[model samples]
Target: MSKITTLPLGFANALLVRDKGAILVDTGINANKKIYEELFRELDFNPRNINLIVVTHGHADHFANANELKEITGAPVLCHKEAVYALQTAGNSAIVPRNELGKSVFEIIKKNLPRSTKKVNPDIIVDSSFDLHPYGVAGKVVYTPGHTDCSLSIILESGDAIVGDMLVPSFFTGEPCVAYFANNEKALFASLQMVLQQASIFYGGHGGPFTKAEVLDLL
Candidate 1:
């Protein structure tokens, strides 16, 4: 069995998936080392034991502290090929509003829509499914773009998936729904359906480890 722990940050969460070693997915907005150090102590995990760091996408909220964490844990950073430019430039992919709330929120934070982080070139840049067994887990990072062209999801053999921003809950209602900002809703729905077909639970950066039933209703 694998253990998925939510490492809460200010506005989002960085997930720690423990199997033989551990895999960290996402690093919240501008997260610092002290936060993770404290979190590691609380979890009773060695800070240096992170075998891999998977940035679910090129969003600042997800990849912000990746470089810092890599320096601390000595873990290899992996991202999709499409995310390379954003990661290398310390930039983020665009956020295209898909709903009324999205439009409102985007307007409020339009200037900082795609937040910035310190540049960190990924060790592995894959355009196709990448197996995680080499990193001490039975999982795969598959392309699942919609929220962003570079979006990716990690699907574990244990029926748990870490989807970046592909599935977001409403800011007002907190109900599971499609992404507020997506490059293509049709593609997003297809990807969501694909993931739901395989994994029983979905973990998103902003919200939850929602059950399949909850997500199915969104579809």
Candidate 2:
């Protein structure tokens, strides 16, 4: 059986999936080295057993510590083909505001978002569905765009998904919503629909692990 553990990486939530080996999704922006080191000590999980590291998107918060984590675990990094440039350059794509609240959030992000210090060259890049069996996890990385042009979501055998930023909750209310900001609403909707058909629970980059019904209620 595979189990998912949520690593509270400051504002971002990175996930660890356990099976024959472990797969880490996302690397938090701040104090990552200490967080993972402590997590390993607490769980007694051998970092060497981590085979793959998946970056949900190119945002600094999501991939900032990717380099640090790679050094800690000796695992290969995986991300969408579209996200390769951003990762390699420690750059980011333009994020469009989806609503008034999104506009406010974007302004805050522009001012306070920390710069990514390390440039990470990806070992594996896929623009379509890719199986994780070779990486020791029973899941697949499915391309889900809209929050960003390069977003990806992981669909585990357990029907729980780490959806990157495909769905984001309200910053003020802490209520689950479709997304706070989206690059393309149409694409985001399509991706959500596809993911919902395969997964029952949704885990996002921030604030979730929301149920299918909870998500639908907000939608």
TM-score of each: 0.96, 0.96
TM-score of 2: 0.96
Q: How well is each residue in 99-210 modelled by candidate 1, as lDDT tens digits? A: 8988987888777564655888899898979988888888989999888888899999999999998877777788877799898888888889889988999999988889
Give per-residue lDDT, candidate 2, residue 187: 92
Structure candidate 1, residue pairs in collision: none
Query: Model 1 RMSD to the real structure?
Result: 1.2
Off by over 4 Å in 1: none
- What is the per-residue lDDT of model 2 for residues 1-219, given as tens digits with 9 covering 90 to 100? 568888877778778899877899998676567778998889888887889999988887889878889999999999998889889888886678888988888888887765578899999999989999988888899999988889999999988989988777787887787876788889988999989999999888887889999877766
The window of 10 residues in a row where model 1 has the poorest summed lDDT is 109-118
The residue pairs found clashing in candidate 2 are: none
lDDT of 1: 0.86
